[model samples]
Target: MTARSWPQTAPDSKDWVRDAIEASGDLVYDWDLTADRIEWVGLASGFFGTGDELVPDSGRMLASHIHPEDLPQRLKALTEHFNQHAPYDCEYRLRLQSGEECWVHDRGAVKLGEGGDPERLIGTLRMINARKQHEARLERLASFDDLTGHFNKLRLRDSIDLCLKESYEANVTSAFLVIGVDNLSKVNNAFGYQAGDQVLIAIGQHLDHILRSSDTVGRIGADRFGVLLPRCSDIQMNRAAERILQAVREMSIPVDPARVHVTVSIGGLVFPNPEHMTAEDIVTRAETALRQAKRDGRDRFTLYQASQQQNLLHRRSQTIVTEVERAIAENRLCFAFQPVVDAVTHQPVSYECLIRLKSASGELVPAAAFVPVVEQLGLVRQMDRHVLELAAAELAIHPTVELAVNLSGLTAADPTWFRALKLLLQDRPEMARRLIFEITETTALQDVEETARFIQQLKDLGCRLSLDDFGAGYTSFRHLQALNFDIVKIDGSFIRNLRDNPEHQLFVRNLLGMADAFGLKTVAECVETGEDAGFLANEGVHYLQGYYFGRPSLERPWLAGSQPVATLPALKSGAKKAGAA
Candidate 1:
């Protein structure tokens, strides 16, 4: 405390308090009652927006620094303190040297001289403004993912809600989409959890770089991001999703080149449909589309088709669910074998077991139409196992024929499934060699390391694995490196257009060559017509599968001895092409 003269004009206890307040970082001011004037820390001039003004004149400017809202209250508190010698305590706003508003905390003392007249007054003021701002910054950071710094799901939902509000208010179109990184689990397995974080960070940065600032992006789930696009058309949303896909596929994170690849699958919903749906229906609608996308084999985008969504949702109802259950229990789920041909020999290489369900109305529901519903309701594994058993029974009729069945990624990852599959293979030793498990690139890449090990285990049992539609994805090569597949089917698109489109011809060529380079057999799918057969043969494709060869038949008509001609289904390329000639 600053020492005082022997007169002891002020209360001795207030001296230490005044000295302590003055030592604080912010300015402190005091009024010498005996002198009838005010005094404050030199830095007070900066806090009061009077950095160049003389100290005496700065006090008036300090009064002006009090926010207009609190100016009257501040003046009242000050007047009462200085005039009545009342204890002073108040928080007021200050205008800083830069003319920015900040909060100032002030408290002081009024002491009387022995004569009972006010001899001196004291106070302290400090800026607590930055601390308050820091708290707000921390709050904001909490709403985002630390690794990617993308808004977390909480903020994402809010952003979507806000976008919906704006869209409804403005009478404009808007979209909500969920994008998921394909095969992210594989990245986590192959590299490490940190590497997975790196991949997500890269995706977030890339999304930020590619998307407009107005679009909202968030980390909605592990390995998933949600985006809200306001005033967007359906076509525009699709384009934006494609760009995001391309961006991720092309983005090479700063990791080892071999481990850096990533791709995204997107599903979107457009609203309000003014004529049809309401704003609140948007997210559920988007989720419905997302389910379709995942079912369609990841990496592709699906727009909500009401009929399809409703069909699946209807299956969720008790009636359809029971129908599916009854169909399974009654062996009403039928299987047909589509022959995959060895192009050069024009003979069956393997038969893909496609499932069909007999509806209550006796109509046959094709795999393409209802496997989605089956997968959604968690019936795929049951149906898959039933088909295998059915195939086992049918193998009694055609011992030498091979069979390949489609299993969902979800089913394959099931541990019970692996055990069941192992048991099935053990019981059917003769059919084991002929069983080729066909899995899509999406499923195969889900946990590349784990799936690779699983495939190796199958290979050890003398079974073959063929990538179902190899060129249909961005991470095909990544899958190839991760799993040693015996065969890779070039996607049907290239083969479908092989005859007339030269670009497709080139695609077929490159794909076939790549397969050969890997010492793998190639299957050219959807090759119809004699022209397609001729073109694929010319390119030396190892296997050819299409309707032109033979449609999927319950009886394996092509392999039947003296088959009934009427039993075979019509081929897209006509009966002439179905013949060996």
Candidate 2:
């Protein structure tokens, strides 16, 4: 059949083609490459928002309506199709007659004439504005923070890496700064989290306004931001940090009924030789400086200065973190049971489970040697979970022995930890009853409502709660009343020399009085001498724990022939006191 008669052979065939093109929302075009003239069909006038009078009849006229930035892309796609016989497919922005821009997907095939030279082109243009808008939203989410509309952590790190590469190649200097919000927790506690969020957003805006156009800012943490400055030197970084500090300090952010004043501590590093540094290294150094700034006092800036002592400490912390991680993965994390004895009887009542890492050399590393580093590195949650698992397993094996396990502040506030507790105690009322969980006063006060809820949850599961390190944080009587704990362990400092120090004696008496009023059991920690132990028992302390009782031992104290406590000279002294009475 001839091409001209083919349409006539099928009734209403032209109508069907036109309906399909209009239904698909695509405008079809036929272009005569030699003449550069174009013929449009299928909603050309409606698609371009123009009638026949302004309809583009040639490629050159159509190019005028294409967005300037997108015209090059369209030309490149067409050239590829014409020269290499490739299928033309390009997405670009098109300007409508109303001056509104919309995304369009342009695809076509080149129809070649004799001698294989391109003579005609047929293509379809579909408005993909909705799809492009969705894609743009997704891209924004990927590269920018939702809260601040600044670069996200991943993108910020990538930008830092790119800057480092460029700086190294050009043999120039660059800087990275970490700014931490001061006392944000206090703001959250005082005015609620919504107000805290407003403070963060306001701080981000302030940073954006203060930094130069070449600098990049990102929300790298909940209350921390990272700034990357390209082509920056030491003096430039110091000046930039001062500007950021001054800007944030002078601004008052509105949070509804209340206005909040905020300040930030900045730590920065100027890397003249970026070739040897990674993004992580740079960030760590800057954060280190930031910590020093915070230590010197908030609302200040500190530039990183390399010191042998600081580097050694950093290396040691890194080594300990690596070793702790390895120890956790290899099941080398274990507990040493330190006996908490009846203050009067010197008989083991329960043991506090202290965490210890069994090194490759088989030496037990004390928690003091590594716990601070672990907590600083944000690995305490995992460490706390491991300690819980060990404590639970031990409780299962020793039914009669009650054990107390310490919980970190981070773990105490974690919902997952509560969930884990529920799972471990499920259908095991006996195990729960024998388990005791200890949290310091500072930990409980970190988020009092949350900690109270956590304590109640533990109590509901039949586990006893202890307020560890009672006087260390100068906890108020109201906080003590709010947190429902089964026991209150006096801070070790107050108990160290109870017999020798009258001040410590008075403090202990008052603490015991408060514990008595609350109907809480009292345990005096660091009872290292018989005289101190005797004084505590006479004062009605419920338990005593320290080197004088027995150091933390790896051997299960409940097992046969295990001496959990030293031969208590305090017991003999107590008998003498009773005889004197």
Candidate 3:
């Protein structure tokens, strides 16, 4: 068709249309149906290159530029539009002149002839490269963790579901495994959180590299990772978990001038009966196995055994519940005091009241034996109040003797326990001043905001606070700012080799320095020899507690009208420290 045969237009209107399409950043095209000729009006030349010769057939010319993968879809859409005069709205990749690719949204409709046959096709193409790139990035973010480059929780769950479905169809077994970094918090406490992040990144890379290609690894928790293996058998699953654990055990991560090592506690669940099992059930079982591994001892892998559902651990948990309920009923719950003595004077500054369980035979049970059982039974809050009541009673009689009572994380998480504690100290104002509540670092980190409020309430009641196991969990400088405690008890794990391990010494020194700057007193726990005590004293520890000082006794040393240091026997000559021994 000649320019004159085209639809009527004012003089210079074609020029105006060309200018408008160029300014709008659109590529305009016209395909003549009958004549089989093509014409490009706007920046089409700018993208396809200006000097290119015009081809008679638009489809042939466009085919050369359209990406091969997008060619079929574009052709199908074009064919429908040509046959039935359908609207064309599609996105496809276009190869530019510089051999780079660009995404564009193509939109238009067919212009019909008088005979009702298709005569021409016109369309506008706008570059959507940026939008496509943005969408790709968002897809990646939704599927993977930014720091560790592992699958995110949502993606991991979906992948596990897919694998389960596939395994069910094939009548095959699949496995889910989880690994928890045992001392990540301690690493964060000793070094910085950045160092902790580095360690996690290293671990993720290691797992991704070492695991089989069929397995998917993901970051499941703050210091935990999950692995999904398809078509895996029981033996294969156990071997995979062990291999990962061994690999993690031997890893030496660098913090600075010194290197820090870490170990993993792994749990694995292999499908025993695939029928009626969901992804969540698999994950739960794997987590249970992981917890058992950590409880038994970290740096190992535990496979979830179906038989264990009726095993001793479960029976023991039930027995503990029964025994604890009986003790509370018979008033057999009691407290034993372990003194925290002044570093220099060796006089007991405060007595840590430990909860003891007295049997029907009048034998006292150790805290370690029953404390975990009580916590698991969800009776920790009750135990906390029991300790609070006994400690308050002791404080009431001995006004000068200060008592430090342990509070579990379960107790700290509950507001009712705090209320009970307040009620106990309501009438005895002097007793509140003499009471010190010790909360573990793990417990405080569990719910920082709630624990902070709890700490403030107790502090307002004239009671002091001590953060027990200071270096054990992930106690960062941020925690120090979040909650103010009067005392920081150096974890016995570090104090065990304080004199022999330079690394331990450095950590304790750093902790002491930080605590001192915050106006918090430091206590060295498990100081079992004169040498350890002397080292702690030189390092400016305010208090020391251990067998070297005094063991937890049912009888209070202060009640005997004698100072703890005077009554306690001195360290035996040439006797190794408790840690050394």
Per-candidate Cα lDDT values, in order, are 0.70, 0.83, 0.79
Candidate 1 contains a number of clashing pairs equal to 0
Report the lDDT tens digits of candidate 3 across residue range 473-566.
8787778988989889888878875689999999999999889889998998888889899999999999999888787766777876754332
Candidate 3's C-alpha runs over 4 A off are: 1-306, 561-581
Q: Which candidate number has the best TM-score?
A: 2
Superposition-based RMSD of candidate 1 using all C-alpha atoms, in angstroms = 23.0
The digit string of per-residue lDDT tens for model 2 on 160-189 reads 889988988898899999999999979988
The Cα error of candidate 3 at residue 74, in Å, is 77
Whole-model lDDT for model 2 versus the true structure? 0.83
* Candidate 1 vs candidate 2, lDDT winner: 2
TM-score of 2: 0.55
TM-score of 1: 0.49
Indicate the residue-level lDDT of 381 in model 3: 65
Candidates' TM-scores?
0.49, 0.55, 0.49
